[model samples]
Target: MDTSDYNNACFAGISSLFATLLAEESQSEDCLYLNVTTPTYRGSWEKLPVMVWIHGGAWVTGSGGGLYDPKHLVNQGDVVVVTINYRLGVFGFGWHQALNNTEGGTLKGNYAIRDMVQSLEWVRDNITEFGGDRDNVTIFGESAGGWSVCNLLAIPNAAGLFDKAIIQSGGCPAMTEAEAQNVMDGVVTDLQCTGTDAEIRSCLQGASVEDLQLAATGDAPAGVNLNMASVVDGQLLPDHPLEVIESGQHNAAEVILGTNDEEIPAPIFIGVNSSAAYDDILASVFPSPVDRESLRQHYDLWQYGSYSNATAHLQTDLYFRCQSRRLAGALTASQAQDVYLYEFNLPVSTVPTTHGLDLLYLFANPTPLLPLSYDLHRDMLERWTSFARNGRPSGQWWEPTWHPYQTGNHARYRLGNILGMEYPHDDTGCDILDSLPNYRYMGEPNDWFMTRVTPLIGLLDWVLDTIFPSE
Candidate 1:
């Protein structure tokens, strides 16, 4: 939307970044466009590693074109960075009885995820022309984008598309099949459509796109609006992502998984109208008794007279921390690939490391309004670019080297007024997650609690070390 803000940061040898439109016509038919940033127009030299970013918007909103500005990553990382736009909302993931009777009926739901897979397939085919290494590509995203990365790792067709991944603030503990189907049935009832898959498909195909959009976002009988989200369609997605990861049945791409210390505060930037509604939503989603008391105690002990920050604590733990740990553990169990875990503990005053705060650093912007935030951004660029160059981030203070996430010695990057490492042990937040209902894996459950859970707990040790330095 705002291209002018990106003109100066472009580097030499880096040609004009452009968006190309692609389309597929068939059962898996949809728009397949991608925005690419490259160092040169020719495909003569050896292929450069590629970074494909998937935007985050609950799988309902957000366009890859809207979320990224290629100036920094393209020029600095020296790699082709492609941001993609996929189908969203109902057009992306609604399921109906009408489609069930058609060929490949088992692939009814999960259209959005299919679009993502298709986008990757396009990259695998076309990135070579943009001076990109087709054989060495990394997929990264935040929030729903992170969820999409996890989904990509699980999809059988997406195996060789990426060599590495970085997921921030999302995980595989997404909606279950029964839960998703219940939402689907409710949507059908709300639309007053014939229950048959074929009839529903025909009716939807003929309906106005606006009408479909409204129906998808509208409140349904289940009290949860069913929009564009991946489903357990027996074909595209045969099982939950966690199931696949735990069973070691996923792609063998190396992974970097972590979350912000405070992820919930970002929504406040959208508007305050939904504060009460969101509070209820948080309560419903992360109902806690065991962890709540322990968290309260920890807060009181650590930041005495800081009870107001409790809300930020609860929100981050529920939406970011817990889910991140679950995903890391599941991937670690795969043991088929490398998994690196991290936690961004850059505290902004009373707010714990809020959501999207990490974006400032990752993007490496030069905005003057947030200077302290920008310095950290520079450090992030150095580390991340180093990783892009050699699969490992480099820096004097923030180098990412610790025991693997399963060694009970989790390493976190503490980026705030300064950047350094902090190992939090005795936190036991993942154990609290394990105590919850439906938290256990159904297929080949991995004993992640014993292996990877303590590394996160080690964070408490880091926090303590910071408070009482022996020097």
Candidate 2:
């Protein structure tokens, strides 16, 4: 039996309330690190392919190498896996006009994205010693991590760092300079640090992490959502992700991107108890009377049987499914390289197929929670590793011929109890949702969808327990 070692070094995590709930160890501001997992190897010239993982906590919370045990992926796939930690919340993504002025108004904000690129640079320089093929690297992530991978594709400096990417349930969204400055101004006001540019810079540096965290998240008006996201600073990130991809300026060549059958389920729905509540949310999301009517008609209550389910499905389409398709379309139009799409339709008893559920079968952690079928587990590992090894995600004894996602095609591999290619199941609603001008990516100004969903992030803990009952 070949031996494998999974190194998950604990580092200071992001200082946010969400981080507090998710962290088992103490969290501080000084949190930039990464973990590498490798399998046993002999003294040979051949090295294994590498896959770097970026964890997801909505850009504010979450660290690498804690819950994601890559031992099984390393050993079974015979590859090296690297998990990384980047700054979160204000420390990582907070931006101010004064800070930019202090530094001569260069690319400001998006420290988290820069940290991720730095990790890739580390892998390029040092992964050879760990028996990995740095040139044959594939970067993959879920949620924010997936979002990071998508944003990294748009970053000019991140070019040639990795060869392939797999983005799971992440949208490609970026904020304009004005939006980012507004968010930072609010934080500065909360901290009571209004004065000269020098004084503001000093205040930001001297403030405690706790105070920063509270200032970042506290006392916001009822409708305002405090989120840390990538900024279109015109230097680091040259343009919006969609614009970059369409202009053939993106860094990715081979990609596998998709979402779960139901990325946001009813449990996180929280307050939508009736049809009226659902309509109210729709009005808020699509302020235009015509757009709201189109959506309401598309997600009518009779079809879904209840507003709770309708709202949940509508959100899944708007935030995850449709956005993912938009990214895939952009990739297909820009490059000839393979772009595969998928939908994790596998449903567990008493559980809705939600975000991050596909990970359980991919990593196949041997902790003995929900025992997935051997066929399903094997299929996921082979498909993912196959993509990492070669650009194509085919070539297994028991596997069917998988197709690359193509432009004008509405087909994606359905990863469920019965796996095969299928048509876009929610196209009607996505059609209406995508038509809305404000539904551009995720970080657009005045986007209320994130405001509605951020509170429900805490409920993800319950979703985790429901999936892994042993937790």
Q: lDDT winner among the candidates? A: 2
lDDT of 2: 0.76
Q: Which stretches of candidate 1 lie over 4 Å from their true place?
A: 1-31, 40-45, 104-106, 220-228, 266-283, 286-308, 345-352, 396-403, 440-471
lDDT of 1 by residue, 1-471 (tens): 543222211011000111011111111223345678776343346677788888765565556544476657777667788887666545666554555558855456666687788888998998888788788888999977887898888888787888888898876634555555555565566567774666776766776544554455443211113234576666777677878887888887778778876675533322212435333333443356454455444434255333334444554665567777777777777766667677775535764566666776776476656534655666666665555555666665544343346646555556556566677786565566556655544221111111111222235435534664322
| Candidate 2 local lDDT, 151-245, one digit each (tens) | 98899888989999999998887888898888888889878997999899889888876677767764432212336678889889988888899
TM-score of 2: 0.89
- Candidate 2 segments exceeding 4 Å error: 1-17, 41-45, 103-107, 220-226, 347-349, 366-368, 444-471
Clashes of 1: 21
Best by TM-score: 2
**For model 2, how many clashes?**
0
Using all chains and alpha carbons, the TM-scores for the candidates as numbered come to 0.76, 0.89
Model 2 weakest lDDT span, ten residues long: 5-14
Candidate 1, position 207, lDDT = 63
Which residue pairs of candidate 2 clash? Answer: none
